[model samples]
Target chain A: MSGVRVLVGTRKGAFVLASDGKRERWDVTGPHFGGWEIFHLKASPADPNRVYASQGTSWFGQLIQRSDDGGKTWEPVGNKFVYDGVPGTHLWYDGTPHPWEFARVWHLEPSPTDPDTVYAGVEDAALFRTTDGGQTWHELPGLRTHESASSWAPGAGGMCLHTILQDPSRSERLFVAISSAGTFRTDDAGKSWRPVNRGLRSEQIPNPTAEVGHCVHRIAMHPSRPGVLFMQKHWDVMRSDDAGESWQEVSGNLPSDFGFPIDVHAHEPDTIYVVPIKSDSEHYPPEGKLRLYRSRTGGHEWEALTNGLPQRDCYVNVLRDAMAVDALDPCGVYFGTTGGQVYASADGGDRWTPIVRDLPAVLSVEVQALP
Target chain B: MIRVVLPAHLRKLAHVDGEVTLDVEGLVTQRSLLDALEARYPMLRGTIRDHVSQQRRPFVRFFACEQDVSHDAPDAPLPAAVATGDEPFLVVGAMAGG
Candidate 1:
């Protein structure tokens, strides 16, 4: 048994699912981060011992937690996020707090360039940055709900910051996706912001702009290519060659157009993965089928991988942070669903296998290949 | 009399589809309505509240007149819309990221 660590963030708490790299013999660990809802969990690729999670509490508010011992123990990134020694007010609409952060984190990612740098997207569609290994935090400015804060609105779950992509080579280059509120980019270290969602779409606004409710769910950047990016829109999967300044539909060949999260292979940039559910009306897996689609050459063509997956109807949707690929040999792919099921692929998603079943409704899935 | 609306998933579990009417005195609290619901449909006992603490599960959300009442205390008196039977007390399961 080789060491393969799987971290799952759920509506209840965060759990660590450890495997021997065989996907057969696995052990599950506690509700780390306590009663807080965890939206995102990440195990460092540079240092497997360093793990990070975005978590929210019903009464404690939104916060980030980090673990040096994988998922065994954790501490808050910052006692409280401060700006100029003062905490910034939370972003909310109509007095009610953002619905997504009811009690969980929606996204947490560490900068690929600097291991100490961390980013978290919370329920109020706010983005927070940590540079001292999560010891202290600063709220990024100019990326709030914009002019249409109330009108843009949160979906049923209530939108928030869900995507954070940092360029591996440049710490200044970062992207944040605001569900129901398109995408925003900062190249000058958060001093200013601009809408990068040129081709994204939204139903509420007839002629959409990049600053409106484009509702971007997930964003994946090609490891080596700084400008090339891929995103899972609320309605379709899209790609951008100019770092989100523009996009094009890459979901023509998939089983269904509707989906949530999207991921790109670390080494093979063109290799991407997405779980397609039925669109707006049906909202289930395509034809009540759960299959992960792998695109070898961008989204031009997709191959459904289901060698060992369930052939029955699975309407459970996969969240944006739930599907991830380990930067291991042959590349290990993993995803958890609302059905409390986790599926893994050791050979680059060519085949699939269930690792855990009937846990809590999974909110996110993270993997760390321990040496 | 209080009318409670069960979401599709919960409706299937309650067996008798659509809204259910309940009669309660004093205030229409979540605890009182839930008790009435469980008394009428025993199968729905543990579905909405914990069998012991009677706490709501993660997904099940309570709403009255479009406002989320999930976080409200169980003993809190419900809105007039629900208490007077003019509107249904909705037990909606929040659908979110998996």
Candidate 2:
């Protein structure tokens, strides 16, 4: 009952880490999706037995694979996000698009209220909401075919929706971040949307537009208090006290303003974690030092937590979906790097330890504390 | 033009080892440089650009100076320095996911 299962996704495949829960010794498993890059992996909070993975091959395209019995045997879901000849019609293409046109699923969030309900953000600048698990999906037309979509540009990964924050309290209320397209929030489900880019910077336009392109990398919300949110922006890390209406840069004491991912504690409303990278220069942690900054008062003040991290010049980059927190008593925090290393802190971000290192370029990480 | 630093994976596929220098003729579009790169490396032909459409591969990325050149047109000419041999054309295996 105390073992915490850590799932590490990589460019090559996915690995499962089983820990002893104390002085934790993690056991690694699989290249799971078999060479296809696993962009996102999640273990359902409602049922830890159910695991979902988003994978794509350079030559094969994208597919969603689910594992019902942990990481043992896997099966591809019947419904796919394939694009056929029809423009407006939502079809699941088998990855035969032009070589440059590759649709990758970046993030997957199983609805907090319903395990059967799921949402995924794709690289083609669209969001797919699936009910009855991954069996079928309907493109959230509001975010997918929005009017301002024509003006929204992709970041390094191509124009796509990266983060979708579903309100834990009111499932209908949601927040979505479109890379280079700014952020959007929907009060009445996905029927309509509005721009929440106030106080954010967008270099693509001479003056920042009201609706999009602030290069938002990741967004996280306080599970209990849905309105309070935190974002790791391309230029700044911010906090939205009033349900993302406005934001203020809270990276006052952080190492770097530019970072890819930020996470709030699953249980603590004020506690948050961020992997700070040198924002203005080439994306890497400051001085090659991997420091996880934690804020006790909702990013107002920060402290560097580096107990078991590398004490040398370690220049590795952590992507948007890499760092995440597991549902545990102390709340386990984990992150993987471009250098093929995975670091976990069972006691939140206070003390850090490497679960696995020097494997392959890690793409994403998900931890599920076993029930 | 923009100098691209090739990652080890692409360098090995292209053979010749290290960062192979190339002078791209005309515009330095992703397709043009990849075409030039494939022509010289031979082994790297389908590695960077698709064998059929000759488009850039999904996993392979083109970066010069500090910007991503993957989305750029294949026919568009690259920067003058890159075309002249001032900087190395980087063929990178984009690090994604985690």
Candidate 3:
């Protein structure tokens, strides 16, 4: 019988939750690097046994931990993430030029074909790649050195490169998203990048339709259909049919479009998920109800999946990296909340169950469906 | 043997129960002691200080003979007591941000 491993990163540590394909009766493992903040944990698609974790703290700084035996054992790897050259400057919150500084690793994306190759999206917003499996990291440099980089400012959460997507159909194509600096795509494998935010509009910035200042919260692409990308912006849930060349608003009929953590279904290319918070200012669910909205036809139509979720007085928020889906038969959906709950739905989003009720406010959730 | 006391988190990370002892070949100083400690426990490299700049992290401090020597030069020799192992050199995580 196959099983699914849910790798969860929380403010305190990392946890591994394992369950058979039945999706019931889980065995929980960690608090792995206890007392440290684990921003993200991901299993390599080519090698499930190789798991990478981004562990750090404000005082202790950043450390990357890798587990070779499927989260059973781990060792600290390289933590050095110096920029490619003399790090120049990007726009500060006050519109003043500020030197680029390394803050923390926000996301880790392992190569789809090689376990030893991984990409890291970091705060202060830059992309770094490691070829010898987390042993060393070098900045990609092209994305940060774009002409518009000087005008890229930090979002409310600090300027962070939070989303990384490698095109499954094209080896040379890759996409990365940065908060306060829209989406960027590299067709020649990080050699050069171009901003792909033609249709994104943010009222907070002076130029609502500027080429690079929109705060994109998250972007998700189904592995089977890499060209169709879905994004949950700071204020709208969007969809791009031509690989982010242009995006159209799909927030139609949802209670509130201001939300984070958008994801695609395991088997269905047109199906997607998003948690609609009340608004940007109110980071909780609308009307105190926790709902996981699912759109079977991509977007413009959605239904609330709230059978086992809290429906009243629940004010916790779901972060951009907190939602994930396992490619198990019948499709298993998982998400973590700020109130320290990890919920799983065995049969798509029809129902829900909490795998672990209390943890240190989950930051990211990734699932691996084993054969 | 030079005695060094690491912060609680570092101690946990290094999996050491108490003060760690290392053999320092040259005159015991903050830089030399930390170099030996990180060499012995490779995981603790960037925790105490930066990997590139090698500057003491803002919240990390050094103490010997109950004196704050964090601002002191990294190459400065330690107090006699610490050098002689009579008083263990302490690496403290400053009491700020919870």
Task: Give the number of the best model, judged by lDDT.
Answer: 3
Task: List model 1 lDDT by residue over A250-338, tens digit each.
Answer: 99789787788899886898998988988765656886678889899988699988788776867787877888777667788999999
Q: After superposition, how far is residue B25 of candidate 3 from its true place, in Å?
A: 2.7
Cα shift from native, residue A363, model 3 (Å): 0.2
Q: lDDT by residue for model 2 over A1-371, one digit each (tens)? A: 57878777898888888876673787788877656688888877777878888876664456677888887777666335643233342222222232213367888888765666788887776778788778776677676556666556566767668898888788678899977777898888887888887878656455764556578988898778888889998877899888888888898788787898899897898899888898646888898788889998888589988899875698899998898887777888999999999998888888888888876788888777776
What TM-score would chain B receive for each of the candidates shown? 0.92, 0.78, 0.96
Off by over 4 Å in 1: A21-24, A33-35, A77-104, A145-151, A209-211, B1-98
Ranking by TM-score: 3, 2, 1
lDDT of 1 at A182: 76
What CAPRI-style quality would you assign to candidate 2?
incorrect
True contacts kept of 3: 0.62
Provide the DockQ value for model 2.
Answer: 0.05
List all candidate RMSDs to the true structure: 11.6, 12.2, 1.0
Clashes of 1: 4
lDDT for every model? 0.75, 0.75, 0.94
Worst 10 residues of 3 chain A by lDDT: A86-95
| Per-residue C-alpha lDDT of model 1 across residues B4-92, encoded as one tens digit per residue | 88865446544667788888867789999999888887646555765545788776788998899899999999898888899899887
